[model samples]
Target: MEKKKELENLLVSVSENDDYAFRVFYDLYYRSVFRFAYYFLRNREACGEVVSNVFVAVWKSRVALRRIENIDAYLYVVARNEANRYLKESRTRRRCLSFEEIPISLIDRNSPPPQRRRSR
Candidate 1:
């Protein structure tokens, strides 16, 4: 089967609550999603969490999956958003807790430092 048609069928099946179809979709995209998220979150644990969260989002929003034209692009966008969310929540926690309380790995050094806007 052509890749496009296969993905379309998978999406339709998943929207109809087919667990096996969802599993096939997950298996097909899990690695790419993981690597895409890892590019933002270097830590394995955090990346794993992001991957889980992304899939959860997918499943929760499965009814709408068939309407999505480009699954790969949609997945990447979700992964990026989740990774950013994780980073934001981690920063908030670090602010509330002592520096020594949080593990050093949560600090995302690969993410560029926030830029300050210049006010006139």
Candidate 2:
């Protein structure tokens, strides 16, 4: 109860653009955000990126911090969104074939058209 009240006060301070309070908030919540992101993104590098994005979001939206009821849930939601975005981009990368990956035969415009099988 006391801790929750204290956190609310901290949020108010953070909302007022206090760098020290923001740093304290980040120090307290960074690990939780990182772990939540890690659960979605198993790769350390991707998780690190997600964590950085989450904190950047928090800092950018500091003015709205006081309006948030549950900071933990808010942070987790942001982390999850970032992780999902990374996963989505990775999927897109896998689906897109680079120019180098295209086979030489496919690139040969003069190649004969593939023969269609005749109906039995």
Candidate 3:
């Protein structure tokens, strides 16, 4: 069977409350979604987390999910958004924790001057 037909059938199964269909869909798409997510996260664990989260969101939204022309495109869009969100948060965290923003007075000022050090 063609891959496109298989994916569409699985998506229809999801809409119809079929567990096996969902499992099959997961097996088929997990790797692609993970790879797509890895582009943004750069870490395997974080990429896996984002992929799983995207699947969960898709499952939850299945009831209201409208007619999508391409299942792969839909999944890719979801994975992309999740990865971008994670990347943004990670960047924000790095920005917030940067040492350059710390007050200069907080630096250790008790060290002796380099010129005053005696020869070893």
Most lDDT-accurate candidate: 1
In terms of TM-score, the best-performing candidate is 2
Taken over the whole model, the C-alpha lDDT of each candidate is 0.94, 0.90, 0.80
Q: Give me the runs in candidate 3 sitting further than 4 Å from their true place.
A: 1-3, 64-66, 95-120
- Clash count for each candidate, listed in order shown: 0, 0, 0
User: How would you encode candidate 3's per-residue C-alpha lDDT over 1-120 as one tens digit per residue?
Assistant: 597676666678887878887788788889889988887788998898899899998899886444777777888899999998888888898778458776555565775434655889
lDDT of 1 by residue, 1-120 (tens): 597898899999999999999999999999999999999999999999999999999999999999999899999999999999999999997779677775555676776666779999
lDDT of 1 at 92: 95
**lDDT score, candidate 1:** 0.94
Q: Model 2: how far is 35 from its true place, Å? A: 1.1
Which stretches of model 1 miss by more than 4 angstroms?
98-120
What C-alpha lDDT, on a 0 to 100 scale, does residue 111 get in candidate 3? 50
TM-score of 3: 0.70
